[model samples]
Target: MSASDDYKRLQLALEAAGLDLWENDLVAGKVTHPATRTFQELGYTLEEVGDSLAFWMEILHPDDLPGVGAALEAYRDGRADNYRSEFRLRSKDGQWVWYANYGKVMSGTADVGMHRFIGVTFNIDDRKQREEELTRINQLLSAQNQQLDQMNGHLEKLSTTDPLTQLCNRRAINERLHRLVSTGQPPSALLFIDLDNFKKINDLYGHDVGDILLCQVAQRLQSCVDAGDLVARFGGDEFVLVIRETGNSASPFRTRIEYLCARILSILAQPYLVGDLMLSTYGSIGVVCFPDDGWTVDELTKRADIALYRAKHKGRNRYCFFQPNMETELQYQNNIETELRTALKTRQLELLYQIQVDRNLRPVGAEALLRWHHPVRGLLSPLAFLPDAIAGGLIHDIDELVLDTACATLGKWQQDPLLRDLTLAVNITARSFEHPAFADTVMRMLEKYRLPAGKLCLELTEHLKAQSFPDAAHIIDQLRAHGVRFALDDFGTGYSSLEALKHLKFDQIKLDAAFVADITDNTTSQAIATGVIAIASAMQIEILAECVERHEQLEHLMRRGVDRYQGYLFGKPLPQSAMEAAMHSTLGAQMA
Candidate 1:
């Protein structure tokens, strides 16, 4: 076919495909295209059918011109096989339209004098607009997802943390402990910390000040632990620390754990500044090492609690390790507490009277001591079960029982001429003495039994002297106003002070048995006992020497001017029937 016929057929084929066919003559500096109508429709016109290259250049978008020029140059130099680009071009109305264009050097190579370029252009504005809108929506969704992820992470952190201290809560700590036990990686020690005297602070100050103190405590605990370790607030003033060690080996870790515990104690004991007030507190720690203590969270927690009880019991502000014997003792105490509650109702509780004598060995009064006759354990002394009663919060019931028994015995003795002259002394726990109705209860018992208040002496331990209670002095004064005698029992053993002695009225001071136990052999004991006696004498308080098991001890106390004595040497604690028999026999001998 002739070239003219082929060219016309080619133009017809390009028109049918919705493509615009064009040619650029390099030597002539002119361009020709068959689709003049398409350009006119886009708000552009070719003033001449085959115009110079400047006409197309004037209509191209400024941002896409450089790229299109680069692509065309590469194709003309034969660097690329074909020239193709997607760019925006200005239309007749000044709106930008997207177009895909393709061209190639059809007439000659780069070495030739001139080159002819043939190409096709297609309008792509609709497809490009759709793609841009889809891209914008994707970016918006991605940003929203990132924000939601951040919020979810924050909420999860809040759930596992304690808001006040910003430490792990009980649930989080339990999970951590469980993970530690299950993995068995690095060895760890769980230290249970209980703030000593924190409750007293809350009672003295307000909860606001108490909360500040707790926050300060939490900061102190965090400062003492390593970064790998965790300090969690287990509610209130209690905290649990997970101390992560280097390896599974425990021998070398023992010393480190001890040092850490001592360091924690020292740190927590420091005074804290809460607002304008400076408050002091200490911590009692209970430590249980992993695997050695237990293989589960619950087991370790229980063992740590047992050790904590021991720490508090031994006197607070110290740490104790879990001992096997402690578990056994705890179980036994639990059993005693369960059984002691029903002892009184079942008529198993009895009061035994231990005789108190004057310097000449004549009966002056008797101390009412509690004894439990258990169905399974036979006769049990207070030393065996009293602690359990106190721990179980049932000491008040036992105290009331003892008072009732003592008052009934005194009422009965009132009818006996010889025994009526003897007084009765009942020991009162610090807990019971602080009761709001303690004084009223005592007065009613006195009135019911028809016994003079002077004949009933209430004994309180020296420990009660250190505790500050607003009503303590008032209670003592009220009972004393009615001629009720009071004695400082177990004096010189606890935190007793001269100020306490001066403020609280006491008719007598009973020396603690520990001092009398070795008063003759130990010079220190003798000096202490003598010093106590001198102090009591200066106060004009009657002195009573207790646990005097030998005649020499009695003689020594007598020479020291002691007025009363009670010990095994004089007589052991006897039941009411035995005491009655002994009292009658003594009366019969005196009459003889």
Candidate 2:
């Protein structure tokens, strides 16, 4: 086909398709198009639209010209693949309408007359109007919700928002921690910040000044963390930071935490002028990581508290990561005592019995041991808190509970044939043993349960003071009269004296665990075990070995005439329900 015929067919197709085809002679500054469709749609005449590129510029919105010019420049300089502009253009009626223009700049060659910009245009006013309307509706909804919050956010604000610094409170942090952990996106590090010398500031300057200083410190703490990271006021002079994102390895992640804590210390060390006096204070930060230091909120907070104490003790204005050994020191005894009291009050105390067995490893009886189910620390044995309990004057109370619980279990066992004959031993504190009514309490328990003969034994520990010796004989005599057995516990560890004391009638001598542990290896342990077994044999008293864990140790002790054995080789300590279940299983096996 001829060129003119092909061009006419192309123009006809474009016009039918609602596209306005246009071209510009760049060097000559002239405009041409196959049709005036775009101009007619926007209420402009062909004559008014004019033949010059300058006319198009005159009608374009001033705000859009700069963008159009940049697009044109980029295309003309070969920096862009094509020239495309979305802009508003004024119509003959003086109303602005949206239009999209697309074109390609081609240099003049033999096929064309001059350098040309060829393109198409489409009026997009309706689509633009719909987008603007949707945006307006969203903004209106957001504004209305904000207004509602301002008007009716009473209890919600009181629970989550802090009144003093306008930051989050500890309660909010706890809730957020729960949500985050539930969603499997818990924070990586919890930075617990405590201001140094804050109490002195409160004392030297008044509490009013202290309050203002705290508010200023809260602001600085917010500045130290990221936008999504949580910053909360954990109480007076104490702030907490929850870091939302850190790498997931222990070593590199801890490095980042160390760097972040250092940066916070550096930033907060700056002096702040509150009212008239310039206040200078720095922070000590304790850091704990998720899945490293702990996973739960209670555990993390407990670990962070320990870390913070260490930081302050080592000297102020420093940061410390949580370490396992820190909680083992005497520094935490007071805290343990306080929380242990709460544990007892809240019924967090539990008792587990390690099944004691005869020579054939048959379950005979069990030892009732106390375990503390701390809310933050999980299940803990006696060594973890007994020293503090003793110093805090709580051991006596603890013993009373243990004694009562053991007796109750014994009473429950009387209903089942398999469990009825199983003797249960409970440790008795020196304080409880010395009480004048101690014998009376034991007598009542013996009468209440009608416990089987030799089924309830009171194991006397080495904690008895010299003052308790005077009354020990009388207490022992009364309890023995009621068929309650007495065992001298830890026989070789310095309290081997019921024999030497000459007044007490003890039924059993439990070989101390220290000797049983190394009976096969250590000569001294062998000698002690042999001596204990020999004495008990001559006296016709039953000799039981404690902590007889290894098979070798058990075999050796049995050879040496040890009458009974208790330790992990038989079974671990079990709760009451578990103990009953185990007894039932054993009874079923024996019957089969």
Winner by lDDT: 1
The RMSD of every model to the true structure, in order and in angstroms, is 24.5, 25.0
Best by TM-score: 1
For each candidate in turn, the TM-score is 0.67, 0.44
* Least accurate 10 contiguous residues by lDDT in model 1: 146-155
Model 2, 6-104: lDDT tens digits are 999988766544457888887788885523887787787888878887778888999999998887776666766667667898888899998777777
| Model 2, global lDDT | 0.80
Tens digit of per-residue lDDT, candidate 1, span 1-592: 9999998998776664556777777677777443464576576556633477776777788899998878767666787667777688777788988876776667776436445777777665665689775465346536755223332333465567987888898988999998999998667899999999898899889999999898899999999987788899999999999998876546688788899889999999988998789899999999898989899899999999999989988889999999889999999888878898789689799999989999888888899998899998899988888777888888988998899889999999999988998889999988888876788899888888998658899998866745553467888889898878999888887766465686788899998899888877889888988898999989999989988899888888888888999999988999999988898787668778
Error of 1 at 427 (Å): 1.7
Off by over 4 Å in 1: 1-155, 246-251, 359-362, 415-418, 434-444, 447-451, 465-474, 492-503, 512-533, 547-560, 567-571, 584-592
**Structure candidate 1, residue pairs in collision:** 43-92
Q: For model 2, what is the error of residue 321's alpha carbon versus the real structure, in angstroms, after optimal superposition?
A: 32
